[model samples]
Target: MAINFRKGIDSSLDGVTKLVFGAAWDRKAAKQSGFARKLALKSGGKINLGGGQKDIDLDLALILYRDGEPKRIVIGHNMDPVHGAAVHSGDNQTGEGDGDDETITLNLTSLPAWVTEWAVAVFAYKLGTNFDQAQNVSLNVYDASNQGSAVLLDELMPTLGAGATASIIASGKINRDATGNPIDGWTTTLVDKAGRLGSQGDDTAVLAFAKQNAGI
Candidate 1:
């Protein structure tokens, strides 16, 4: 399999079957400044709401494929578990933490034999929101097969033009080998793209994105 080394993160998945995909970001820098001031206020100072800055929320999702067809979507908090916890999602509504705000875990070994690919992505869920509204936004994959020694496999911090309206970022995918053995010989490829893939209030957004990514 030819890997897109230049646009993708190349790593040895020789013995890795459990992977953790994480996405994180902070409130826009301008918004954070006001929040910072609120924290630094005197004892009786009134709390500031950052001048009514809009809250930024991002969601992590996995679109699973079976026999080259988009089959299921494992969306954060909304669609929690797929295949009886084979894939788990950790969703954070408020990007208040220091680390990953949203996460999706994939147990490749538990996936069905027909499953072929899993597309990774993150999107700004707020109406009319885009990547330009957040700060330090990143999507990453980690090899978590080890008990407590997970290592970062790869990561990408997506950005946009001054006023681009794209909300979703297709980070990449894990392609099962022709042998159909999810436990081994799977390749992780990065195909970073930022654009609109689905409509607001649509439940099939992730699946639509998945099909488009798979060229189906």
Candidate 2:
């Protein structure tokens, strides 16, 4: 299938049973302050202050949302599954290797009843450097059940600067019929907002952006 994404535009991925959000970045050798590290440990993640493994260069965070609010976040340090539906595949401190440096997988069919959306985002644990230090790895989504087929937006992920710390790549929502009736499946949405997106981002900022643009 052909996949496309536009900044601030809403696309549909309805009836998608399985989805994957994956990314890769060149690791920057830097460390966050002690205070910031403590805060990240205190709260699963950080807001604008930036948090996570304190040593991780970049990470893929899968956020579960209900009614536009973040209920749970899966980061480098906290890789807990959400309702047995979503799982993070360990953190890759460096984007040195090939393929996906990090990944998150979700089974839409197994999500809990209360879970409404899945927002896939990536953040540079280090705020001082942006994607320029990394490759132009466009955050991507794939059909996990279809033999890991790429959805075709490999170049859609913007190469952001050091200031743009976070990027909300895309989302998946429960499906509904034309009559506005609920269905027993889920749909996908391509949200590429790196362009025009400011440098300010964190767990809180990404959640708000996802909910507002999820088209829920």
lDDT of 2 by residue, 6-91 (tens): 54544555545666767766544445788877877788774325432223367788878765566778776667656457878887
Instruction: Estimate the lDDT of model 2.
Output: 0.62
Off by over 4 Å in 1: 1-5, 8-12, 29-53, 84-86, 161-184, 214-216
Where's the lowest-lDDT run of ten residues in candidate 2? 47-56
Off-target runs (Cα >4 Å) in candidate 2 are: 1-15, 27-56, 126-129, 146-155, 159-162, 175-181, 195-216
Q: What tens digits encode model 1's per-residue C-alpha lDDT throughout 116-206?
A: 6667777655467666767777877777887986688666666555543333344333455677654436666555656664664354765
Instruction: Give lDDT per model, in order.
Output: 0.62, 0.62
For candidate 1, report its TM-score. Answer: 0.73
TM-score of 2: 0.66
The C-alpha RMSD in Å for every predicted model, in order, reads 5.3, 11.0
